[model samples]
Target: MRPMRLLGLKTFRHGVHPPESKDETSGLPIRQFPFAPLLIVPLVQHMGAPSIPVVEEGQEVQRGQRIARPDGFMSVSMHAPASGLVRRVALAPSISGRMVPAVYLEPFPGSTQEIEDGTPCPLEATPEEIIAAIQDAGVVGLGGAAFPTHVKLKIPEGKFVDTLIINGVECEPFLTTDHRVMLEESRDIFTGIRYLLKVTGAENVIIAVEANKADAAEHLRETFPSDLNGSVEVLQVKYPQGAEKMLFSALLGREVPSRGLPLDIHALCCNVATTAQVGQLLPRGRGIQERVITVTGPAVKRKGNYRIPIGTPLRFLLEHVGVADDVNRVFLGGPMMGAAAPSLEISITKGTSGVTAFTDTAAERTHSPVYPCIRCGYCVDACPIFLDPALLGKLAATEQFSTMTDEHHLMDCFECGSCSFVCPSHIPLVQRFRAAKAAVRKSKAGAA
Candidate 1:
């Protein structure tokens, strides 16, 4: 075997190495969380226009029944996770801290967890037909982006796609959803990839996984028959290696132009879990109702990977997982890019990949007094996209958001939090950039 070398690993430049913090749940098998009293399926789960509710309050719905329809091409439909009665259509708290229109369901007593909904499409379905099936199944990028899968897969006019990149690199700490999925649901993942290859007509497929999960890579290598024009590439365990641009560069050595997508480089990337869902759901003609998630952190009593139903409340998850009374913070994703949950009443949407709770001790922030930058270039050294975070943070502090974007290349930063991680002064650089970006967007919207 080749010697293990961190420097020899395939990775991009300038990223931080935070604590892995995954041992607690990495080895645990995925368990199914019991149904909550009520499910709150939100319309605004996807990135585009929210779905429109097709059912009325007090109406009955079956498992895999459509409750809402897409409002536009960019939007996606919504489905019921269980056979139940519609409790009401009302505004509910979302992780974004905003109230969104949602369909509430009171599941029928003794309803089995089986999904018996959807019409099967033939294996030889045409590309257009497959795209329709995907849209009908309500598939989205499950890697936390939640962009409509069909929108990303549909090759636009005058454009061509050559390669499909499947991301199995669950590099985020304390999250093992994708790792477990890659191991337990390997066949489904490949089935999804085959559909993806057919959808985009890509010449080849590449599945990128981190070195930490070499077993998953090896399993795929051994079990996956060699005719799919696909290969498993092991990436160096690095923070933000799962970022689309960084992973693209690390694997292909090609720089995606700033503000450009993978499709611009004749490559399209999809989360492995998302692809697996397409493969699993489309053939059965069923829609997505739940997904695998990691419910792990220091404060969680029963830490493990879970196949959780979509629309399960955060309170339900915390109560089911048995969080400590002294839990200081709960986040919706991983520590690096995940957002803090504002309320326990907020339901888990399709985009939610992990539910993490940190106790007071684990969630403590640096108490050292904030100091001015010492002209240290640590932030610069840690930035993967080569943006000067110190400069951008200063510009943001002064409310010069326009200057930060136009001259300093502020938007290029994917907010992977590397600069903040390495900053000796403990400056909240990522927070500032996010605020600056939001401000710029708001300003542009107001002008428009």
Candidate 2:
């Protein structure tokens, strides 16, 4: 097949251009973070029912041992990140602002991080076997979504996938986990893609990297095996271009419906880090207990990607990295779409991609007053989904969220925060939309 390009630069419509604050750690190689004394592995780390605890409190467990069984098919299991004694099986604070069931493990001083249990599977396994191995490995979308990777490998009866798109577009500022992974784990990525191809029966795969990381793109293209049916596509740099929908547009010019998914267009997109993890774990029959994460921002003393255990607490991690005394805000993901960490007590989960702390000096510009919208169209121009955030913000202010969704395409907004970033008014448009969405979801749940 001939190489496909979306014309010059190749990008989707309407997005913000935040300063790429990645200079600090973009070039730094990944380093391993020492295990904290205790880990808090949340049962509901993925987007499914929380896992049911299989081990009782005070029970000793080995690193990578299964302590919680998946609740159902939609859920994924949880594993111990280190050899330790189960301190408790109780609620813990999550970045989601809710207390979720989590297993607290106090690591043994002499504990080795060696994973001792796994049934190695052959590469030529059947689709069912491959998917089962993936699920047993506990691999999820390491891109921050934390969706179980096994679920994506299963092809529905009628639906056929054509392309497995590996998203290497770390478009968010100050986050270079995917970029570093693409450079360091290219072989694993290819291995994982081949496995995905075998499972889904997809014709080919494409690794999409933004032009900002041209080196990674070049490296992947140069390193991609000649035998495999895959290629590397460099996309135009844009915020949220890393989003699955926007990525589809930039790479294949396919538009997923407002409420639809990439699967609707016969495409599967997984993060580069997630792909590497799958490639590394499935063959060994090992579970996901540790992952590489970017710890950066102005307030962080050591801003680099570190491979950390799944349940390491943010407080301990931040302290090790040496956060500034004046740090006022911390986010679990990227600033644009990441959830604000409610407290430092929250532990890192599968979904965590980065931990960004901002000092008062750095936060001054971001904490500006909420000025009223001046009828400027910057928000509309910046909206990638073409929704009127200005009007949505207005409707949200007056508690007219129902009408906003019914008529103004409120549900279509993915809360990329582009509108808010571009707005001169400093209106918290994204926050308003989030509140409105929460309210709508709550109302629907109540009605149901």
Candidate 3:
């Protein structure tokens, strides 16, 4: 046990400072969002193989009961979010605009919604057992990546992790779900940290937070347990600072090798919200059924943080939040990296952290004319990864997808949108890069 040290503000080179639009919901406490009559629980809410349905249509399930089982080690299980009868198990619209297999559940009106618990994993459980419990619990990176948490915790045969980093640096604007989770779920966070420490065998822990979340930092400092070798490090406010590579550079000054993982550098990073879920669920033998989300934007009349059930349809959520008549576009997650909803019928998944509704006026601001790149070097100056987006953009325009990856390191671009944000020419640099990368992947897969 050591005293939790509050480190001085630190940051990596080259990032943007988008307007911090978090004030609208940062102060709001998380409230339980009312369930929609029909919950569309997608089987592919996470990365990897979609969970296979274990309960069939017309079956009754209690809240927290396992509805789908993980297909394999790379996948995670799924649970019922409420006491309901399975209406159907068919293809449903997901946030990604894909029609994936899903369970359509209709909640019984006035039901107790009692949760069915499984075998709890105790603190003293072995690392092997803990990892199994986590996968069975269906925890994933709630910070938007939705990578299965159990898969991440399983260290490779030869690799060793000495440090565990809890990421609380929600640098994306208009998103305060992680901030609210930090303030309200401190106890669960610490408990999650313990589980992560055991799973990764990390002797030291660092909770990385941006200076913009001073209140969250202070709250965590006050509640930090005196038994763990961990500290809360406040970082300089910057866009994409929460990325795993950027966090490594800002805190440890270590650059993860290009295309390498955190474990390559003896470090493991987990989202604060994800960690809190691990702490909150494993001990209770519960699977993840819902998550905290920040629902806000200019077009929203009731902006706040909410504990929303998984599979809640976007249309229902927006209706509950009261959107403006002129609401023209709605996106899941933050503006910089979120995807626009192709249909409001798409259901929220584990990866969704924020819901932003923009009016026609707000959407029109981004419709500026696209001009040729002037080589003003603004994109290079703003790229956190130090790749030349201008060159990559040109290669993409010429359909030189292979050249873009081979010579310009186009694949290294995380599509943080900083290049597009700072580009004076208003070119869709990030969008172009995304398309180019997809082309490259398709080519490689076809050749294989």
TM-scores of the candidates are: 0.97, 0.97, 0.98
Tens-digit lDDT track for model 1 on 1-448? Answer: 1223356678887687889888788788889888889999999999999999999999988888888998888998889988899999999999888999999999998877567767876559999999888888888889998999999999988778787899999878888899899899988888899888988999888899998898889988988867788789898988888998887788777778888877888888999999889878988889999999999899999999999888999999899989898998999999988889999999989999998999988877645667788769999988989899998888888999889989988888888899888899989899999999999899999999
**In model 1, what is the error at residue 190, expressed in angstroms?**
0.7
User: lDDT tens digits, residues 1-448, model 3?
Assistant: 1112235468888889999998889999999999899999999988999999999889999999999999999999999999999999999988777799999999888997888999999889999999999999999999998999999999989999998999999999999999999999999999999999999999999999989899999999999999999999888888999999899888887788877888998999999999999999999999999999999999999999999999999999999999999999999999999989999999989999999999999888489999999999999999998999888888889999878888888888888999999998999999999998888899999999
Clashes of each: 1, 0, 0
lDDT of 2 by residue, 224-292 (tens): 899998889888878988988888877777888878777888998988998898788877777889899
lDDT of each: 0.88, 0.88, 0.92
Best-performing candidate as measured by TM-score: 3
Candidate scoring better on lDDT of 1 and 3 = 3
Off by over 4 Å in 1: 1-7, 366-369
